[model samples]
Target chain A: MTTQAEHRMPTAALPADASGLLPAAEPIRFLDDDGGPAPGDAHGRYQRPATELLRQAYRAMVVGRRFDSQATALTKQGRLAVYPSSRGQEAGEIGAVLALRDTDWLFPTYRDTMALVSRGIDPVEALTLLRGSWHCGYDPTTTRTAPQCTPLATHAPHAVGLAYAARRRGEDTVALALVGDGGTSEGDFHEALNFAAVFHVPVVFLVQNNGYAISVPLSRQTAAPSLAHKGVGYGVRGERVDGNDPVAVLAVLGDAVESARAGGGPVLVEAHTYRVEPHTNADDDTRYRDHDEVEMWKRRDPIARLEAHLRTAGELTDDDVSAAREAAEAFADDVRTRLGEEATGDPADLFAHVYAEPTAQLREQARWLAEELAHEHGAGEAR
Target chain B: MTLTMGKALNAALRDALREDDSVVVFGEDVGPLGGVFRVTDGLTAEFGEERCFDTPLAESGIVGLALGMAMNGFRPVVEMQFDAFAYPAFEQLASHVAKMRNRTRGAVGLPMVIRVPYAGGIGGVEHHSDSSEAYYAHTPGLKVVTPATVADAYSLLREAIADPDPVVFMEAKKLYWSKDETGLPVRTAPFGTAEVRRAGSDATLLAYGPTLPVALQAAEAAAGDGRQLEVIDLRTLVPFDDETVAASVRRTGRCVVVAEASGFASVSAEIAARVQERCFHSLWAPVLRVTGWDIPYPPPVLEKYHLPGVDRVLDTVDRLQWDDAPDSRFLSGAAT
Candidate 1:
């Protein structure tokens, strides 16, 4: 997926300042397109995770795929208001999120349900925002996770701010911020990167180059050599990785997270992935992209490739595959039952969180609304 | 101690940094150049580069960093080089910073201050002067305040920085060097509390920030015409001190809101609407407003005519009719 037509890796000119990120000549790769080990010596720097961890990672990836498909089906059945499927980019989602320590924070965007789920958030609660209900559906402080922001690149700066603040207050916590290709063009992205670079804040930024921001292609996003190289301008080091290869993504993100945790400053890792499905269930991707082009990417599916690797290694039995499938089915069944229940959106909840102390105006407005709602019901109830 | 508004602000920042370890001061050239208006002058020399420093010329970046730092427990006091330059960071301010605490259900509150030098009259170029309090006052999570006195600049800024929520402090560029030599009065009220700069009984004139001086001047001019005008300096716009304003209007039975922001759908409009609702019985005339025309800040030569001057305030009050003509909406049986 990190091909020439889309990402033309350009040479960055620089004076090598005290803290500029050194660009990797090529995106770090650990696996071939067919799931076989690729030629690279970079992985030799650190010990690979235990075999059991790899198995768990594989299961998590499978679960991520199941969630994506189930959520898409829910959207079709009107169970979910909308869903932005991380269908083809599950590797980038699972790999980056799993690398973070429990104490660290995860800043996800609207399309990052997989990342949130991997953090132990309940599936139904995770979809509350996507389901178009109340504000972000979970307690961020308890989970150390920020609400999935819809505005592009807006949360990136928050990640940098929190990280910088943590460092100043003598806390040891890193922030892992995720954004898409199109989000990289936003001014907030530039600012966050620049701030992270200058302040040496502990943050790991992963830009999932998913080929399109809605209908606009990557070429129209920027004329840079690659999205990773954009970090060089902010004095941040850049690492490009094959986003379709979960193994490669895990290794690269793991290294970056550790580097940040050890106070090596922030790192920008650009994962070359694809959005196999449309931007959202409401979008008609066929209007902009061709089926033939999408077919070429199907060969690089993160889930199928990893499953093929486990089979090739003789680590997978027929029973193991059947057990994973059954688990996914049971999870989906539970989701369907939960969503089948009625949703009671209380009107008073709107005034609950507007301020730490609701202002006089908001209080008055709330009182008026209560009176109006009461009056509408035949004025039978006393105020 | 006697000081200019600029000097008072500088002293306030110095005291804030010294008092709080988490308090940080930064902006473009704010460290080395002391800011264009010298508002943040000499902060770095006393606090060092770690606590006070400069950032890249990206408005969005400056604000984004402050937002994050504030979330993580730093009291970031950021500076926008000019009023118009703040447009780029509007998204960050309106989006994430303003909504984070509310979204988190108050698990965390942002104790940050974004200092903006705003309004026109100093013959500065375009974008150098603008009235942005309305934009921020319109946002829910932010606390918007502006100080019209040298003493208020010192006290209000200290209070804004010390507050637990994000504060948008709009410092008037034109009022920075005014020769008002006075310290905070002993009985001075808190930051959001309104100050009755001058008391009268004919009509109430409400103003804030740079326009407070004009409102007071309009009051003096009205007295020459044998009219007693009460002028209240609305120290803060968001927490809008309605008790003070309503009481004055009830006594005078008239009101005229003054601001440098455009007339249509502005803070002035909000004040006008609220005054009518609260003082409907006491009012003998409809609430009036004297503000900048619905247009952009023109060239330096044309700014005088654009900003709300004393003449405009007096003229608006002069035309306020008190013929005891019942409001059209309350005419006879129409109000039944």
Candidate 2:
């Protein structure tokens, strides 16, 4: 555990060329392909997460995958405007959420609806942004989760500020900001890391390097040795984990979150994962990537691998697997029923909440809209 | 009992920090440097590093940090140092800071103020002088306010920090040292109301921030010629006080907008359109605008020709046709 004194000292005051701050050369892994344990001491640095946590992550991933696919179907049925499937990257998605406490804040991106689902947010509230109902359906203050941010890397500094403020208020709250491989190229990401390091704030940046940001591949995103290695220059400890392995991802991310909570400065964890589906329902993956690469990643599916691991260890039974699938189907069916109806919102809602006290300008506009609506209704009655 | 605009603003920030432990002041050079213009002078000494501190020289990071801090229950007052330097933070202000409350359906509100020392006059070099208020005023969910008097600087900033929404507080750089004989803790008209600084009936000279003083000087100059030009200071641009302005314009029968920003889709243009729409029958002539030409800010040496001053304000007032006679010099012979 990092001492309190160590956490208070800025990185500039620390010794130069500290090896403890560097990332591992290879991505840390415990479970290998085909769900077999990896040979040798590949995961010796960090202890494996509790078995109960792994089981929970597995069940949540199953449900999360169902929710993601259902969301995609909803987009096709015109219930949602768009849905980004977190299909093959379930390990990273579930592990990151499972690593933190409910009090800890999660700053997810637009593509991180699966993480929101794992956080126990109502699935319908999670899909509101894509359904064109509201910008954010859930109250961030109550859920301790920011709106699924759309802009890349903009929320990174927000996490730093919240974590820093919590520290000042003597709260043990940590903030986890999730970013994609492409988001790391943004200037806000650099500033966030640097500010967190300088202030020694309790924040964690999880970069799910899913190989593609829209159509651009990881190779085009950065020339750095690894996205995690980009943290050393900012005085942040960096770690890389096999994102397909739930065991490794949970352990690494859990360790990072705890270290930060214990007052160790912010750490960046890059999970090597793949976007098994197109970037979103609106994207065409065939225009950029090849089919062979997709097939290779499909063999290493996070859900299938975790299920195999659990069964091999006698932790999960056929009955448990079937029960989980049944629950997921029920959840999906409820979502379909709720989203089937057309959303009916008051037109006056457009003028509400622009400010604590609605401005006179907005009041005038609202009056104009009211008149126009009344005219339309009256004309319809005459017709 | 006298104070400069810079000192008044500093007092406002200091008072805010003392009043609420949740208020924090931060930005590049805001710590020991006390800001380049010294508007944040002595704040760090009074409040300590936790309340007022220096940040990395990244504008976007500064604003983004303020947003997060505001979300965590701290009222952050950040400085952009200059007008043009704030461009880097435009995305954060537009995408997140400005839309946080509305996007969350009022679940979250950022009670913060972004203090920018704006506009030209001191002969600074490149990237120093710019009138970027129109960009912020055009954005919804943000209150764009600029104070022309020392007393307003103190009261408006204090009110802005206490407001339950994000505010872009533009501080006129040239007016920092402009002294007022009034004391601190003075109260002006509430926000969203325009003050007729110099009331008259001949014509109305609408201005805000850096151009208010210029408009007042033009009013004084027109008074010397036996014409009474009403000078109106539009303190807040977003929640614009159209009632106050329309009333004054209806009585005056003519209006001329003066601003340092380039003319061509600007706040000045918006005011002209609104005045015509509200007081169309009251107006005796078309609303005129005296603003910087539609070009990038010129070099410091050449800025005198670009910024609207007393002479320029009067020049536009001439087009009002006081005697109901068209000036042939401004008319095209082909039309005649």
Candidate 3:
């Protein structure tokens, strides 16, 4: 994007670069059609993530794909409420998440199962939210990962506040908030960007511009040159990276996270990517998108790009690919076993977490529920 | 020290900051200007800028940042500046702060206090005076409270800050200047408890926040006319002290609730419903509510007419029949 647009700054200049907000022209990319290194200063500075990181990214993408398929199959099997698969955009999710330290937080949207899986959350636990179960599948405090936020961009400010509060306590915890392009239109997104910049909070925002938010496409989402450009108005450093290129996403996100940890202001990175599947099982892509467009994006698939690069470099053999597939299948089988059990929901689950200290009214309500459940079960113990 | 509501609130905030380093206080002009009403006056001077400070004029950002801070272990006490000015942050309050802990299933709790200066009769402009306790009370995960006494103001606010859940603490704007002797007794009722401010034999008056003093005055006027009226201060609105109000109603057999929020779907309505449910047999008269008219808060000059005053409370009490129980449906607005 060109150096354009005026800031809505009302106070002292925010924590931003002093110069004008001129973001890079195209998404910063490092890999080509044949997986050769591209040319650019950012590209030259080793946008090539370490070989180990790439290998892990490859594994994560494969497992993420398998997990996505399993979730979709479970929904078909009458298991989950819904599943927003991160199919074509696995690299964007995994690349940025792997850059975060264990102490750091990864705030995921409903569509970001890949982030949770890559962050070491159990495959079964990761799908629990989709399974219509209680709680956010995993312990957020233990894993430093927030629950799946269904509301668009709401978690952005939370991530900023967490990082800001962490710094106040003399902790060096970075927060990476992930969102879709459509989420950037939300008021919470604007507030989060402004507050994060104003407070110099240690947070990195990653907008996986997955081409469409359900049926709403990117063009209808914003009038700005690009989603990343919207960040500069809040006085945050805005950059665009190739979502399909795992190396570039890792390099850019890694740099942003490191810079934030060292007290650099919060940054916004938009990864240009696509959601190859329907928004969920509930949406129809054919209504708004052309088949040719889907075909076009298939050629640019993140996993295929990475796998080709790995194979061409002789870093990944055919047997290794087969082994990766076998591991992914094993994970899917484990998730299937966990989800196959009959749901024996507890009657008290509704009132359990409403407060750390349940009020008199809530306690009374819980009592009523217990008694009613007991009566229904012929005076059996309240489940 | 004889403390007004504002000074009592200041003392509470001061005590909280002194007690916990994790507690932070911030809002517009809270740092140097001591807040628009001086509730946070000198707090920044006593505590450093880190513990107490100012923020931008954006209310949404203020509350959002505070929620974020709370999620990360900081007990943030944010001022809404004015009652209606807090509307901008309603989305954040309802969607995030109020539901974070429950939605996260006990993994994260929003232990913060959102202080709003609410109520009419303060002769302030449009958005300056509003009674929004009902909105917070309606939200599931929040504890809505308003203290009508100086002791409760000091003690309730300190407890709210220390509570392990979010509390929407409404500071009655009109009561900010109402004073009481502070050194007599520092003891105050804990949150979710109701104390009978006055005692009598005929009827019970249920009121909270800005309407408590009005109910007290109405009780005094009723006494001159040989009609005994007891006053109950419902300091907490959410986990409402139903037992106190219900028991009083059972004994007196008559009731009238007063408030500055509109007559429709209000916190007053909530208390009235609960009292009706718990004391249906003992009730001699259907509960009556004396509240602001079902209209947007009018201009400052006409606020007196809109707010329930002593006369309105008395008029509602007079409408309560000692002979027969009236239809409960008509109890919400018959007197007005």
Query: Per-candidate DockQ versus the true complex?
Result: 0.47, 0.61, 0.52
What CA root-mean-square deviation does each model show from the true structure? 6.0, 2.3, 4.5
**Which stretch of 10 consecutive residues in model 3 chain B shows the poorest summed lDDT?**
B322-331
Docking class of 1: acceptable
**Candidate maximizing TM-score:** 2
Supply the TM-score of chain A against the true chain A for every candidate structure.
0.91, 0.96, 0.92
* Structural similarity of chain A in candidate 3, as TM-score: 0.92
Write one digit per residue (lDDT tens) for candidate 1, span B268-328: 9999999999999998899989999999888898998899999989878876775565555
Across A191-279, the per-residue lDDT of candidate 3 in tens digits comes to: 88888887778899999999998899998999998898987787888888888888788888998899888887788999999898899
Task: Assess candidate 1 and give its lDDT.
Answer: 0.83
Model 3 has a clash total of 0
Overall lDDT per candidate, in order of appearance: 0.83, 0.90, 0.85
True contacts kept of 1: 0.60
| Candidates ranked, most accurate by TM-score first | 2, 3, 1
Candidate number with the higher DockQ (1 or 3): 3
In model 3, which regions exceed 4 Å deviation? A1-21, A39-46, A379-383, B323-336
Interface RMSD, every prediction, one decimal place: 6.3, 3.3, 5.3
User: B336, model 2: CA deviation in Å?
Assistant: 17
Write candidate 1's Cα lDDT for A1-383 as tens digits.
01112111112333367234655666676667888876776444445555565666788888888888989998998878889999999888898778988988999999998888878888877888877676678888788888898999988988987887777666678999999999999888988887787777889999999999999999999998889888878777788888988777888888888888777778999999999999999999999999988988999888777777777878777787888788877877877788766555778767766666676777878999999987887656543
Q: Which stretches of candidate 2 lie over 4 Å from their true place?
A: A1-15, B326-336
